[model samples]
Structure formats: structure tokens, C-alpha cells
Target: MKISIITVCYNSEATIEKTLKSVESQSYPNVEYIVVDGNSKDNTVQLIQQYNSIITKWVSEPDKGLYDAMNKGIEMATGDLVGILNSDDTFYDEMVLQQVANFHKQNNIQASVGNITQHNEEGKTVRKYSAANWNPEKLRIGFMPAHPALFIKRELFDKYGKYALDFKIGADYELITRFFLKEKISWKYSEITTTAMLIGGVSSSGYESYKLITKEIAKALNRNNISFSYTKIFLRGFWKLVSFLKKK
Candidate 1:
């Protein structure tokens, strides 16, 4: 099966090369690697150009934001499965996409979710985010499969629609809710560690981001007609703490 991997970036000069190389090193040969840049001022586009042979398609232009760029990539995708790899994240190993393809082929599921390891600046793993226990019900508590580690069939977007632009930080959460809960998409969990993420991204920043995401999570739930409370969402912090303590 052909898998399409989209990397949405913006002034990602500091780390985009690693992300590019991660895809270039994939053992899966049918990957349609697409990169969408938000008209970066840095050399991010130049770095992407260096890997033009591996990249199936690339576009550097202005965009609304991260989710908007992702939407553009989704629209441009033409593969059986579609996934997003952030500009600062890399696949855990060369076999990740191959593993994902094997899982989907064997299980015949519409989507697959895997694990992610968060790393510090020193390149040490700090936390393991697993989707093994994730289910539709967990959305009420603000839990979700790691976005970078989740891959869905391209047609799902055509059927259910793309990410909601109304959210600043919770668009991913909202889209997951709509797909796994409201629409009831079939998915399976793969135990592979798909992506190795950096410590500080839009959602992983700090207390202030925590507050914003909590509020946005509430908004996402309400928008999807899912019953939830801020207290329940805040309770997810305990799970985050547990993940950090169980770092491998």
C-alpha cells in the first residue's frame, strides 16, 4: 500500500533536516513524502530542496497556521494512508512506516495508532506516550493517540472532513474526537514507537499552554456534543505525570 507522509513546517531551519532525513531513510519504498512550508524566512525550504529526489512533492507558501498547513497537505495527499510528521520530530526508526503498513494490511483497519517518545535537547528520552490504552471514551479526559504516530486512510478526510480551524491548540483533539467518537472510525493500536518528538512544541510547552489546551479541549468536546468537564480534562495531568515517571 502507498503511504503518504506530510511534514508541515515554518521557520524550521534548526531541525527540518532531521525530519527530512528520517523520511528519506524509511525502509518503506511506497511512501509519498510531501512537505508543506509556511513561507519560512529561514533556510528551511533550501534544506528541503536538497532532498528533492526523496520528496515526492513540496510547496513553500504562506498559511494560516499549523493545522491550516496540515489541511493543505491532506488535500494534496494521494496515497492509501496519510500521516503527519512535524518539522521537529523524526520517526523512531527506519522500520516505523513499514510496520504501520504491515499492521494495516493484516488487520484491515481504517487507521492505526502507535507510540511516541519525547526527548530533551540532550537527545535523551523523557517520556513514552503510548496509545495502547487509548479508546474513544478517553477523549472526555483529553486523551488521544499521539498525532504524529497516528495514520489514517486518505479517504477518511474525504468522508468526515478535515481539521477544524476554529481551534488554536485543540484542532487535533477535535478531529480525533470527530473521527473516533462521532463517526466511529475503525482503528487498531500498534506497539511500535513511531515518532521521537522534541520537548517543546505547541502543545508540550508549559503551564500556560496547559491552560490553553484545557480550555480548547473543552471547546472541542462541546463542539462535538461530547459530555466533558474541565476537572476531568485537568485530571489527565496525572496520566502525563505517570508517563514521565515511567520514561524508558
Candidate 2:
């Protein structure tokens, strides 16, 4: 089965090369590697040009934001399965896509979710996020499998919908919640570390981000008509702290 991997980036020169090389080195051959750039002012486009041979398609232009660029990439995908890899993240190993393909071939599911390790600039592991214990009910608490580690069927976007452009930080959460909880799509969890994410993304930065995401998450649940309480959402922080401490 063909797999399409999309990397959405902007001004990621310092880290984009590693992300590019990781995709280029994947053992899976039938990969449609697409990169969408938000008209970066840095040499990010130049770096993308250097890997033109490996990248199936790339576009550098202005976009609304991260989710908008991701929507553009999803529109360009022709493979059966689609995945998003952020500019600051890399697959855990060369076999990740191959494993994803194998898992889907054997499982008869619509989507696959895997684990992810978050690391600091020093390449030290900060926390490990796993989907092994994830359930649709967890959406009420703003808990989800790592977005970057999720490989989903492309047609699901057409059937359910694409990322909601209305959200600033909770679009991914909203989309996943819509599929797994609201729509009840079939999915399986694989115990593979798919993405190694670098810290300092917009959502991982600080207190203001946490507050914004919590509010947007609440908005997402309400929009989907899913019953939830701020008490449950705020409790997710304690779970996250537990996960981090376990990693330590």
C-alpha cells in the first residue's frame, strides 16, 4: 500500500534537514513525501529544493497557519494512508512507515495510532506518549494519541471532514475527537515509536498555550456536542505530569 507523509513547515531551517533526511531514509519505498511551506523568510525553501529528488511534491507559499498548510498537503495526497510529520519532528526509525503499512495490511482498520517520544534541544527524552491505553472516552479529558504518530486513511477526510480551520491550537484534537469518538471510526494501536518530536512547538511552550488549548479543547467538545467538563479537561494536566514522571 502506498503511504503519503506530509511535512508542514515554516522557517525551520535549523531542523528541517533532519526531518527531510528522516523521510528520505525511510525503508518504505512507496512513499509520497510532500512538503508544504508557509512562504518562509529563511532558507527553508532552499533546503527543500536540495531534497527535490526525494520529495514527491513541494510548495512554498503563504498559508493561514499550520492546520491550513496540513489541509493543503492532505489535498495533494494520493496514497491510501496519510500521516503528518511536523517540521521539528522525525520518525523514530527508518522502519516506522514500513511498520505502519504492515499493521494496516494485517488489521483491517481505518486508522493506526502509535507512540511518540518528546525530546529537548539537547536530544534528551522529556516524555513518552503512548496510545496503548487510549480510548474514545478519553477525548472528554482532552487526551489523545500523539497527532504526529497517527496514520489514517485518506478517505476519512472526505467522509468526516478536514481539520477545522476555526481552531488555533485544538484543530488536531477536534479532528481526532470527531473521528474516534463522534464518528466511531475503527482504529488500532501499534506499539511502535513513530515520531520523535522536538520540544518548543506552539502548543508545548508555556502557560498561555496551555490555557488557550484548554479553552479551544472545550470549544471543540461543545461544537461536537460531546459532554465534557472543565474539571475533566484540567485533570489532563495531572495525567501528563504523571506520564512525565514515569518517563523520568
Candidate 3:
């Protein structure tokens, strides 16, 4: 199956090269690479042009935000499967995509996700979300598969629709919840490392991080006909604390 790897970038010159190279080096041959740039004032567009031969399509234009750029990407994609690899992250290995394809064929799954490592610019591995034990229940309590770990069919986009633009940082999280939590989707978790994403993302370490997450979580729960309870939050918080201790 063809995999359309779309990357959304803006002022990402510093890291875009590595991201492109990672995709280009993939063992999977049936791949389409598309880049949606937010008219970056930096060298981001120029850097992309350097790989013009490999890049199936690329455009530099102004967009509303990250999710907006991503929607543009989803619109442009024409592959059997789709996966977004941001300008700042990369695959764990060249064979990652190839293996995902084979795994999907064997399991008859439309969506496949794996584990990921949150990292820094220097490539230091941060917290591994360790989504090996993922499920909707674990997700309701705040656990989620890393965005980069997902490889979904373009049909899923057409079926469930693109992300709602109301959210900023948590749009992807919300999209997954609405799709996976509300319906029976063909999905499987590959017990293997997939992506290494740069840590300290747009919302992770901000002063208003808690507030943003709180709003997103509340919205997600409300949409799914679920309710938030102090008990759930307390248990999840305690689970996080224990996760950290176990890591050490």
C-alpha cells in the first residue's frame, strides 16, 4: 500500500532536513512525501526545495495554525495510507514504515500505532509514552498513543473527517479520542519503537500547559458522552508519579 507521509512545517529550517532525510531513507518504496509550509520566512521552504526530486508535492502558504496546515496536508494527500511526521521528529529506523505495511497486511488493520520516545534537539530520549498497553479506558484516564506513532489510512480521514479547528495544541489528541473512542475502528498497536519526537513541544512545558490540557480534556470527554471526575484525575496523577519512579 502507498503511504503518504505529510509533514507540516513553519520556520522549521533548523530541523526539517533531518525529518526529510528520515522519510527519504525509509525502506518502503511506495511512499508519497508532501510538505505543507506556512509560508515560512525562514529557510524552511528553500530547504525543502533541495529535496525537490523526492518530495511528491510541497507548498508554501499562510495558514491559520499547525492544525490548519495539517488539514491542508490531508486534503492534498492521495495515498492509501497517511501518516504525519512533523518537521521536528523522525522515524526510529529506515525499515519502520516497511514493517508497518507488512504488519497491517497480516493483521487486516486500517490503523497501526507503535511506541515513541520524546527527545530533545540533542537527541536525548525523554519520557517514552510507553503506549504498548494502550486502550480506550487507559486513554480516558489521560494516556494516549504518541501522535507520531500513528499510521492511519487516508480513508479514515474521509470517513471520520479532519480535525476540528477550535483546538490549538490538543487538536490531534481530540481527533484520536473522537474517532477511536466513539466508534469501532480497525486499529492495532505494534509493540515496537516508531518515532523519536523532540521534547518541549508547543505546549508541554508552558506556564499555561495545565490550563490548555484541562480545556482539551474537558472538551474531549464532553463530546464522547463521558464525564470528568476528581477521582479519575487523582488516580491518573498518581499513575504518572509512579511511571516516573519506575523509569528511574
lDDT winner: 2
Clashes of each: 0, 0, 0
Q: What is the lDDT of candidate 1?
A: 0.92
Pairs clashing within candidate 2: none
- Note the Cα lDDT for every prediction shown: 0.92, 0.93, 0.83
TM-score ranking from best candidate downward: 2, 1, 3
Clashing pairs in 1: none
| Candidate 3 per-residue lDDT over residues 66-180, each given as its tens digit | 9999899999999888888989998889998898788877888878878888887778886777677787666577667888888888988888888878887878877888778
Q: Pick the candidate with the highest TM-score.
A: 2
> Could you tell me the lDDT of residue 44 within candidate 3?
95
lDDT of model 1 at position 154: 99
In Å, residue 182's CA in model 1 sits off its true spot by 0.8
Q: Which parts of model 2 are misplaced by more than 4 Å?
A: 242-248
Q: Estimate, for each residue in 92-203, the C-alpha lDDT of model 1 and write its tens digit.
A: 9999999999999999889988999999988999888888888989999888889998999999999999999989988999999999988899988889899999988888
How far residue 222's Cα lies from its native spot in candidate 1, in Å, is: 0.9
C-alpha TM-score for every candidate = 0.96, 0.96, 0.94
Model 1: number of backbone collisions = 0
For candidate 1, which ten residues in a row score worst on lDDT?
239-248
